[model samples]
Target: MKFQTFKVCGLVFAFLIGSAFLGSSGSALASQKVPISFNDYHGYTGTVKYIKSVAKAYPNITKLIEIGKSNMGRPIYVLVISNMKTGTTIDTFVKLRNKRKEGVKNVPPMKPYQGKPGHWICGSTHGNEYTGTEVCLYTIDKLVSGYGSDKEVTRLVDGQTFYVCPVVNPDGLYNSIEKGISQRQNSMKKDDDGDGKVNEDGYDDLNGDGHITWFRYKDPKGRYVIDDVDPRLMVRLRRNAKTDKQLYSVIREDRDNDGDGERGEDSERGIDLNRNFPEGWWKTDGMAGGRGNYPTSAPEIHAIAEFFTNNTNILMAQNYHTSGGFTYRPMGTAPPNQLHPKDVAIFDMIMGKKYLEIIGEEVPEAWKAPGSLARFKEELEKKSKNKYAIARGYELPRGWRASYNEARDRRYGYGMASDWMYMQFGAYAITTELWNPQKDIKDFPQFTGPDARIEAQRALLKYQDEKYGGKLFIPWKKFEHPELGEGEIGGWIPKYRSNALPGEPLLNVCEKHWQFELFRAGLQPEIVITDAKARVLYTANKANSAVVSQKGDLVSIKKGKSKGKYKIVEVTAVIENKGKLATHVARGAQLAGNREDIVWLIGDRDKITHLQGTKFQKLGVIEGTQKIPGYTGRPGAGPAEQRRMQRMPRFIPPGYPMFFRMRGARLEPTQVKQTGPKREVRWLIAVEGNTPLKVVVTSQKGGTKVKNLLIQ
Candidate 1:
């Protein structure tokens, strides 16, 4: 033991939300946890402006950053929330959760938890999946209002950073919101089919309704038929000689727009922003824009790719999608066996089961009005009399079991952003497919058939009767078509029955997602400087002791025969990993393109070596969660990972305490194991009165920790 040092070790709070602190808690100047409802869900532009308003209202902890512009020149916004302090002070001390005797088994007490990681969240990757925009606004609202007031919120703001990009595809998201038609991609100029043409024709709200829903009509020989159990539900008509029910083919509400021999197949801006990431990008030819000509082809995606690449401390990320109501984890293209063996356990049981329970609890069940079923039957009969043709869309998500990977859903999606983040940067990525109507239906419904969309259709019908007085169901109306001749166009309003929730009770559902997201962020590795101190070594008096030759600037000696003393001090600190997961994920460590952060001792420049293992990167502060530099200013070269070391091999187990010395006089170092957490150990060095021995530790997810001590 040297000079007495007081260490304020934060008792790593495992709970993310609804947590109470027993400390010197402070209140935020202007903070309130006000709930923003979906009375009229904020569309893309509205959501963007709302985020800005939140940042303005909470200028101390929030900043509205424009990352880049969409293809259609829509500004991409990322709301950054933090304590807004740039410099470190004595009060900005390291709270190494348990830097003292309570050091966990694996990691050591030599390194302190450095900085809080940035938690990345975004929604509306698929423009038509409108719920994401709302979720983003809701998240912004949470961070803005909860900054210093809410205990959990204060912790996240002061400790960790939050990045919320509400609408990744702003143009398309707003188009879907305003026009009831979302091209599902940015309004870019690209000939999707390479048809020597560009975005000529596709999709039309022919009925003058605000949605491009199903264009259903009777066909003697069609590929789909109305389900016998639920007349409102459409099912695939499998081949069978005995079954003579008429089949129908439902097309998009359009005719042959481009005259490309395909009906409403190609549209302008056919890029799938989600499928334009830099990881595992391959031309699937399975779906349009499934694989852009090159990775990060979309400007929005490019901005996001570079934004994350420039930031290495992001701990976890969630990409919100819709309708499936399932939590999807990585190895997007790889099957369970193809990925790290441990990933299955992480994805299936931990991720799936936990979120399943949470979502099940958050969203309520659908209420069918009494006698609505009889009206539904009458409506079904009237539609049946019309003998309208039935058609099916097979590619939709159907079976939603706890671990329903979309029923053999293993294509790794050519350029899915989720997979890109996980595979390229080792970021813990999750695709949260929101809102499965069946999940809200009575009996806790399960997708028994190949596709459970029909059950969702049934639930929607019931919801319409109960919520909207059966108005959601549009009666089949005749429409003369140039290509398909006389036909009818009528069906459910895609936006009405889709993931969009109408009332406030479902507001809880939106809030519950935040619960899950915050929970995941709590897993960020935190290395706390549990204890730190410095001791004075023997002071050599120049007048009495023999003058020793100095080996460099380790210790400077005064003139001989002089009444002077040379003092040397030793410094040490206790460090512990408070996060549940390892500092860096296994996959992230093995990827060359990912960051391999290390701990370093900052002493006299002459005493330290800039060798490969003992290198130094001056990450002065954990300003990771703030606005990304060069976001809007820089012209993105391409995907950020392209500039990374994608083939490098490096990995360190959680809590690995490495050793280093800023040498002055050669001395034996403390003995310890090759790697893994270590108990307090002494450093051999020379120092003048009160020398500042600073130690900086860094983990990809834990941000950075810089602590200094004075020794005399």
Candidate 2:
């Protein structure tokens, strides 16, 4: 119930120490509907419970979806946060041609939230790296809790869609936390050859302490020595360091359960989920560069791929990992040249700069002076051997970097989710390694130099002792190993060792990442029908009685020779992208299954005939109002370039095919195009009687919006 205030880099942070921070409602004492605590880690069971509660408590804004199942048959859940009734899609208005009487269920109906721009955030791709799970849960708590109480949150919840998948690898999280086994990869039930001869030499709690901690024994060839400052900690020695201290061999608190004389040989561990995506999965040598026989071979990765396939509205994607407290943008498999310069600007100068600031890291000098990039690029070309770095004008900072090994000029890994999402799906995707004890922990001592890791470990032990009463660590105790003569069974608990320490430290990590994602969400493109009106240029009892022609601002109508009840109406609509980023990234529309933003004029199809513009007009990519920092490249394609049409073939009367073709009138479709953040579209149509009209704008990644047109 007590609140404490502190400052990090002059920005004051207020957090509740003993209990979880109650989400916003009115006052500090207001009870949170779905109260959540970061006091300790929430494994799969707890996470599922909390998310389900949020979905039930906030039914209007939240829907819990089981996207798919893991290898262990555990459901992978994605909690969607958005107003369920506020949005609409192009499918609702546009009628398709050649519809079949018996419908095939190839594609499911688009949900209302799909009509809005989507931001996807998932955590725990690796089982042992479950710190991201806590952050994901924390983000969900902030969003659902702050919905009606906070202004910015309210606007976001009402306007945009947020897909939060708290646990991408459910079995890994369960095993890591609940079973106390540090499983980095997901769990698989099958063996290598599917012969049911699964290896069972997984880590066993030999000490019966209910924790799969480390066991250390004396050995001349041991690679670890007791820390001078903290005896409870064991520090690893350098490969060739000659230390005069007693050496110790350390292993997980496990024994040969199957009497195979080997430990953890064939555990339930599956392939690395991050290395199971579809981008750069095959090497140039025709070898499988990624894990598994092919991309998405793992069940967990398959679910993620399928979910992304169905949700094309997602433009911003984040896959969370642990321990490093840094971010990896995209193109990890390829070089920086693979990314468009404009995207690079947005990723580095915009998102990267903000991330470094949030984590209290120094922003690169070149990033601050984006206008001086030309000079920086020149400087890099002369001094740096990394061509990608030279092209980007600066090397990526430690806090925000690509996983690709730029120094060695080599790929980091294959089938990375971020690379797949960006190159193939055209999303602004990134993988953020969450938690850094040095940065996230308030007032933790700064460790540097050769022995900095040992020093940091000592500080963390002391901090946990003072703050958490030392329960976080298990004191080393001598135990008689069933196989070895003697050893001590103790060390930091598996999950607590590498992840963000519980309570304030974990909360701090969660807050910083939530803020970053919130900022990213704010950048999603928002398409809107700003202004729309239908003007009745001419009206007559019969369609042939009125033919319309425009000269300057004046319109003249004369008797014509077409058919029926006619009213020549001119519909003008102003479409704009009011959000921060453009409707799509560079070349995003050209990606398969993606298209340029389109505006549709809807009415009774049978009654209205388009005399000028088509019923639906391609708006191309509607530029956003926000200017991208550090990017001076050409903007996205404007309406004029996007709406270009081929010349219509001259129409020839049916009966007099060749002889009378010269006397026949030539006909062509009319189109009006404009550019930039806004477009003015005009359509001349003949309406039979007084047909109601509406204008709808649809963008694959931007969002869909509609405005009813009133005929005057």
Candidate 3:
């Protein structure tokens, strides 16, 4: 089938002739299982090469485009997969995104996916966190290959357009693959030890085993000891333990290069692309986790930030990571318990449900609830019948344990990507930690004590032995260290646990995470103006309120009998949100400065506009909190969107950019006090002519709608 492009229209013309596509080819309809050739998530030259081949093979459905390059000149490729719905969805979004950053005016925000809304999945940022990259590749393959072959796949691809950036940190991933899996930061070398040297002394395969494993040497003043039952594992010494035998000291597999007597402390200094985002960015010099001198200082992360912040059409976003079967959100660096109590409760409850459906994990509802501790007590008594109600004051529940250190409830992260995307932009952003070995075990033991770690080790080892013939773990062996003398340099290899999931279980992990991603896409806000109704003001009295001559999208009213030659008439349009979340989310509404949620009237009206530096005459915004109006809202008094948009899900300190769309010269977007759950906003205007009225309603979060009402 052939398609026609839409000509750009000025104010009053609402219709944007959507793009169209031909039906699938006969052979393209052949459905088959994802070829292991492309299905494997572990390593197939990364997503860099895979997307190109997929797009080439399926040109009608997939478009391979590069947004920018990484710090090391690696192309940052994005695959826009659509079902011939291409001309409208992908290009419009890309244009809007590009122009928004440039503060382009007169360009309308991209419409919702013509047939379905759009979704963005950021595969990976930390090079070593290979799970997200794998999942992204697997997902892209599923989409392009499964189209027309699988019913669900056909529905998804045909309905929704996907922007998949499989690997966000190309330099870092290549570094890990080329040097060692332990290479966590990207290739932007820095002076980690602040000694005015870069990449001077970092990890080395001290034993020349082609890997970077830890080293433990026998020493009289050591704080660790080799597990007697599992000599391959080492545990720190417990306090008050009586022992006479020589203990051991553990250090990373490296040698001191700066003569500082420290090993691996100043090696391969680079920014952790994940921690270099503007949100929660650490400004102090020499911060940990590869945080660069400034937020988005790295080329890769800055390009990504610039891309997504401008692309407001993104409904859901996920930054994939591996190990520890955990799903995390914003506030990675700050204390988790300090977020808005209600927001925390809602995130936990809603995210918990998704987790159970996807990874079979629990989000621990016993954590913290909304309202104060006193409110919790009162509700507990009323609901729990005072039997199991808490008699003491509220205490924050013991949070999750860190996989590497087994440290509990540790709160620390700065400049994490997920927090920026979600907290600032208000898009549903999730950083997924894939593969928790505990999920595969029955009676999972805790990592509380040395003995407990040994038991946990035993469980994992036994499982690995039974499952993969013990091929995953690198057996402990004695080796000679250059500076530390004789020691053991064997433990769980990077692939064995911390980094990517082993090749065997990777498929299952990808499948589950993909399902969760689809679930999120299903929840994206779909804006609708089907419920919009227009009325013309007729008359008013002390008892009889202002009336309209007729109702509908368009109605013409003549000058009324008010003893005057001409009389003004009011035209009110009611726009309703019919999606799950508010038109724009609660968080997005707060950060959307100047880019308020409202309906636009394009006609011969003078002085109306949202842009500040443009040359073209513009329409005026009526002004409200979230909309454009003149009422300070108080709960049930003002428009629903305004009441909700002003709230901050979490109060982050100043410094980070609010990633909102739309180009407005206002100091900030309107502060919305309310978001939604089936709400309506009324657009009221006064006009004199009987021309066609094209109204565009956009809820920064909900989809956009253009309705034409001809008035005569």
Best by TM-score: 2
lDDT of 2 at 376: 96
Higher-scoring candidate on TM-score, 2 or 3: 2
lDDT of each: 0.60, 0.85, 0.58
For model 1, residues 268-378, the per-residue Cα lDDT tens digits are 555778777876576455444455668887888888987786566676888888766666676565433334423333443344445756766331111112223334445
Alpha-carbon TM-score of each model against the true structure:
0.71, 0.88, 0.68
Question: Can you rank all candidates by lDDT, best first?
Answer: 2, 1, 3
Worst 10 residues of 2 by lDDT: 638-647
Task: Encode model 2's per-residue lDDT on 1-712: one tens digit a residue.
Answer: 1232334422433344212344432432242479999999999999999999999988999999998899889999999999987988777787545332334433566778999999999999998888899999998888887877677888998999999999999999999999999888888875643435784667899878788898999999999999887888888988899999999999998777666577677678888998999988989697999987699999889888888887889999999999788999987887666777788888999899999999999999999999998999999999999888988899999999998888788889899999999888889999999989999999889978998888888898899889988887899999998887698988788889999998999999999999999999988888888889999999887556467888999999898766666788999988888898988877687666678888889999978989888888888788888887778766654322343322335675678656443444544333336667898999999898877898998898888888888888
Candidate 1 vs candidate 3: the lDDT winner is 1
lDDT of 1 at 650: 67
Root-mean-square deviation of each candidate, in angstroms?
Answer: 15.2, 7.8, 13.2
